[model samples]
Target: MTNVSQLARPHLRSLLMHVPDGILDAPTSVGTAVVATIGVGLALRGARRELDDRTAPLAGLVALFVFASQMLKFPVAAGTSGHLLGGALAAVLIGPWTATLALAVVLLVQSLAFADGGVTALGTNVTLLGIVGVWVGWLVFVGVRALLPKRPASVVPAAAAGALVSVPAAALVFTALFAIGGQVPVPLDRLAAAMVGVHTLIGVGEAVITALAVSSIVAVRPDLVHGARRTLAQRPLTIREKVPA
Candidate 1:
């Protein structure tokens, strides 16, 4: 058997959201850029419907939180690490449309100011994280919430479940894209298995963070949680018949 220490290990890479330059071919890069642009455009239009004086500031705060949290990466596997995606958390706190915009802003800052993600691959990152992550998480959250009791507390678990799925969903998308136009030749099966496997573990952390954040907001002000709004609004009004007064 080959000694583990004797084997040459590749440099550790954080695979949660950041897609570096040159990993994808020109066609893949350009295609994703167009898709990301269109998605952001639609998000701009959709956000108007979701945002208001009350939720606008909250949106900013959610973006900031996601930006900060993503910087904290946890080890997932040998030569790989992951971080909080925050898509489900944002969607639950605000609305999905607004959450998409929030993620875009955070990604843009990370790409430009921090150089955390490549400029060439910014669109790919946005497509994977902003569009795929946000929508998948929001859709899952909605589905989960629908199945649970219509209450503010339900939003927490629903958000967590969504978060749990979103990370691996994004990873799978990346694997597909890599298979399509990966600069480096890698077997599809191995790539898919590795990406999905590591991300599934990352998803657990995502779930925990999302649940805590959602629960905190729900406990303090359930009305402020967009995902819980319907539950709160659905509370039956108590009507009492006045007897002999």
Candidate 2:
């Protein structure tokens, strides 16, 4: 059999260069519309929650923030500069479902109004930002809470870690899609590794931005944070479990 090390090398690099730059088509536009509709429903449902009353405005703010953030893309080593995939940060701030809706609105406005991302590629962007970003951010928050102390002090770390992981996760998803439908003829393994590696660095930026945003909110109103609520609920258990141990 081919050596495992040899096998993985090419695929890693593939992730970095792989972009669906040329695949924009009719289906992509329709896809965005569908996500926007679903996203609207999810947003409305979350907004009905009492907590969401506060979180809803944050959602709008998130849309605005994402719009502005994308405009100031920083130079990555790749020819492609990267921007914040704020879905995870948003989800961690509010909730995952609400985040999905918020990012969808951001994307819709970007495509139809601002002409930022390709109107034909709205599907790709939504899948990357709306779906992938939410899950990555949420999972990282859950993980940080599980690994760290249960005190409210852990909020920044958990959010920072969540935000850090969120970016590369989105990058990996894009890498996968690019593998299937990439314009460039690059090896998938190399592409994945390159994408993951660089994005891992970019994720640091994502982490910093997300952590700052979460900390600002937490500082003003800890009760407004859904992640904080979970942390609080799990607090009493830490002492109980510690006593048993």
Candidate 3:
């Protein structure tokens, strides 16, 4: 059997990292930037509708948690490492609109302060992880929750499934961007397959982490979990009546 330490060593060497600039043609990067800008604008509008004094503080806390969690990388393959995008976790904890804003903030901070991703590629990264990842995961979570029992316990599994699928979906979006304007000379089919395969493994980690975090929060404060809030509210109040003794 392969040693677990050997599998984990590559992740330790490289801290949190993402696609750098100049890997894709200018047109692709610019196009993605436009889309990201629009997405952020829409998110801002949506957040206005969703956030209140009570929930706004939770959004800030979720952003900070996501930023810190992203710093830890884990091995996906022999040499490739991936970190939590935190899109699904944020969406489930807060709402998708707030989640998008939260993730965008995290990415912006990482790029400007730590240089974790390229400046030019900021929009691309935001489009892929912040917008696409959050929305896709949110959709999946909603769909799954609709099919399951409307209870807080169901939120964990739905969130986990959403996290599992979001990573590969984002990977495919990256592959499509590469196909459009990749600097490297590689076959599109081969690149897409490789990207999807590695990211699927990474998705398992994403799913586990998202599920655990959501579950912990739900256990203590179910109302704070946006995805589970409706179910929580629907719960019937129990009342006891004293009988004649």
Model 3 scores worst on lDDT over the 10 consecutive residues at 1-10
Residue range 125-231, candidate 1, lDDT tens digits? 88988888989999999999999997789999999999999999988998888888887655667566667877898899999999999999899989888899889
The Cα error of candidate 3 at residue 98, in Å, is 0.3
List candidate 1 segments past 4 Å from native: 1-16, 239-245
Mark the regions of model 3 whose C-alpha exceeds 4 Å error after superposition: 1-17, 242-245
Per-residue lDDT value at 115 in model 1: 83
- Give the TM-score ranking, best first: 1, 3, 2
Measured against the true structure, the TM-scores of the candidates, in listed sequence, are: 0.91, 0.76, 0.90
Tens digits of per-residue lDDT for model 2 on 128-235? 777777767888788887888876667778878887887788777766665555555557776666767878877887788888888888888877777788777765
How much is 132 displaced in model 1, in angstroms?
A: 0.5
Candidate 1, number of clashes? 0
Error of 2 at 210 (Å): 1.2
- Report the CA-based lDDT of candidate 3 relative to the real structure: 0.83
Candidate that scores best on TM-score: 1
